[model samples]
Target: MELGVIDLVGGGGAMVAVNDSTRTLRRTRSIQLDHVWRALETGAWVTAGFRSATPWLSSITGESPSASSVTLRLAERIQQMPQVKATFADGVLAESALRQLTDLWSFDIAGEFARDERMLLGWALKFASGDLTMLLATWLLHNDPDAADKTAQEQFESRELHLSSLLDSMGRLDALLDPEGFNLVRAAIRHLS
Candidate 1:
């Protein structure tokens, strides 16, 4: 028994069809939103392609559409924050970290420091790990206004040392690696800069 099928045609729209075996009836709906139809089509193609290429994904249920949709919406909301966008564009923030920050807090940190986006981006990039970045964002989100200023100052000072230690470790590793491998690392660091 056939269940349902959805077809998205570029520049046209989405065609959805449902078949009911018991009633011997078929229903169809056309969705005209081009952007929405295109997104759905892309998502379907990605899911089918991934499932076909990965043998294990066929056995286990893949990432749910609802979850991916939520993440995409959250990312769109986060991008509205100039500081968040800047950090992400600078390669200092990971998409997963931004999602975690969105899940942890509702307020806009970027709006809070609209004039200090550079400072905010610098602080965000100071964290060597995404977990640390999320923790810092959470701290900033929940801290009282009076304490936030002092806390931000202290966090920056303390985190600077941590970042310095991380850089030292990377430098040591770079010294040990082959010239070609170290050159790749240098290129990545240059790209981040």
Candidate 2:
């Protein structure tokens, strides 16, 4: 039975229907990601007359370019992670959790992730998406402190303070600083001001 907006809002079982629809949508997205992975693996997208998978996915799924790009990248990352791939395929894992895992994933920490996959999946199931993201980030930082340090150093090296004049007599101050630098600058400015 199809649920129109009226039925969705007026029906007694509306919440149940909404919950079921959410599960169905999650499963459908999982299937789509699986197909995207297969297409990437087989070059089926090229044969289907598309230059690349992202555009083809966007065309078919009606997702924006950035969403399609993220989906494509997630598909590639999920392919390398057997346990994550399975959990995602089961549709038990939230998309946000999957994205968080993919975001913090690196080849250097693959083994650690693999070993901790079960524990992480448990947290994914128990925690909200934001909590899961923070948990995964903390896990990554603790497990791969060297990579975290390297990223901090890169950010420090790339830090910039830009002062530009606006149209009137106004000035703009733009800065990109790592955590320590930001704290130091903030302290100095607060003390002086």
Candidate 3:
């Protein structure tokens, strides 16, 4: 007599079943990622009459658009980094952590990441997401000492303020400010109001 899943609830093999289920989910995700990459490379979505892969993936997989978009982005990122893809395939990191790791990859730091991929992956396993982010920032500072200044300058350059009248006679204010500008505006509002 074979045991069913219901029978495994209070049985000794429950943990094994749970672990196997988790691994299966990870393996399925890995396979889906591979297929997504292949579809992008081969323009399968276009052939299927979709404008882009995100909608196609969402429709086909019954996942939300945002989730599919994230998966597509991660697939693209991991495709460029073979070692990271392998780690993900092996279920070394959970999806949230892997998303964080892939989000950190950029052309500016690709070479450095490739060189230290194993160490960083180990960190991903050990550190919380926020700690991993800080560690990566520190790593970036070591590689590029001017990164902080460059980022500040970029923020300053991109600042904007927009004022509009809403339909119900309310004013709408939209602003994007650098740290210094934000402080100045906050102080002015406090003084005036």
Candidate 4:
């Protein structure tokens, strides 16, 4: 049964909603924030209107040369925020927000990462595959493209992989997006197009 919903703005920049069942609808609560609401509504409309998209927003966040270091740092901070993280865990953040947060978090995660026996991307790619990485990267960047480094340009410069192994193991960047996230990327591609 559809439950009655109440949007309740809380202290500390948080918004909450109590469903008829007393559970939270975090996505609905996020819409109470003016800027986030705008991002979500606009992204949703773009997706509905355009079915074919190129994920320009995602690309811009992670690989665009024009993005600056400061932007990426800001994105990382945003992703790390408690409210945003909670919303994300609850599946409330918009598609773009999720991508943006994921991208920024990746940068932070990557920096602290120490890989000896296990490569982070390799682990992700092996069991989870590149699509998951793609999805996570998309979410992180869509939330903030400027926050991601232009690693796309330099990925090859720094990474020395046995070409055969990489080719055999690497899944397509496609199929990475989760359903909601996929829709967001599609809208981003269309909006930019």
The candidate that achieves the highest lDDT relative to the unseen native structure: 3
**Alpha-carbon runs more than 4 Å astray in model 2:** 1-12, 48-51, 149-193
Q: Local distance difference test, per candidate?
A: 0.42, 0.77, 0.78, 0.39
| Residue-level lDDT tens digits of model 3 in 12-122 | 477666666776787789888998898899999999999878779978987655567778888889876776678778765667778877866767778888898888788
Query: Which number leads on TM-score?
Result: 3
Residue-by-residue lDDT tens digits, candidate 2, 70-146: 88878888876777778777666778888877766778888888889888877877788878878887898789978
What lDDT is obtained when candidate 4 is compared to the true structure?
Answer: 0.39
Model 2: how far is 80 from its true place, Å? 3.0
User: How many clashing pairs per prediction, in order?
Assistant: 0, 0, 0, 13
Q: Which of candidates 2 and 3 reaches a greater lDDT?
A: 3
* Tens digits of lDDT, candidate 1, 8-124: 455323332221321122111111112333444466436655542122222233433333344344544554456665455444454555554444333444454455445545554
Clashing pairs in 2: none
Could you tell me the TM-score of candidate 1?
0.32
Which residue window of length 10 is worst by lDDT in model 3? Answer: 1-10
Q: Candidate 1: give the clashing pairs.
A: none
What shift in Å separates residue 47 of candidate 1 from its native position after superposition?
Answer: 20
Candidate order, TM-score descending: 3, 2, 1, 4
TM-scores of all predicted structures: 0.32, 0.65, 0.66, 0.21
Candidate 1 stretches with Cα past 4 Å from truth are: 1-62, 66-70, 90-92, 104-110, 113-117, 130-138, 141-193
* Per-residue error (Å), model 4, residue 39: 32
Those runs of model 4 whose alpha carbons end farther than 4 Å from true positions after fitting are 1-81, 106-150, 153-193
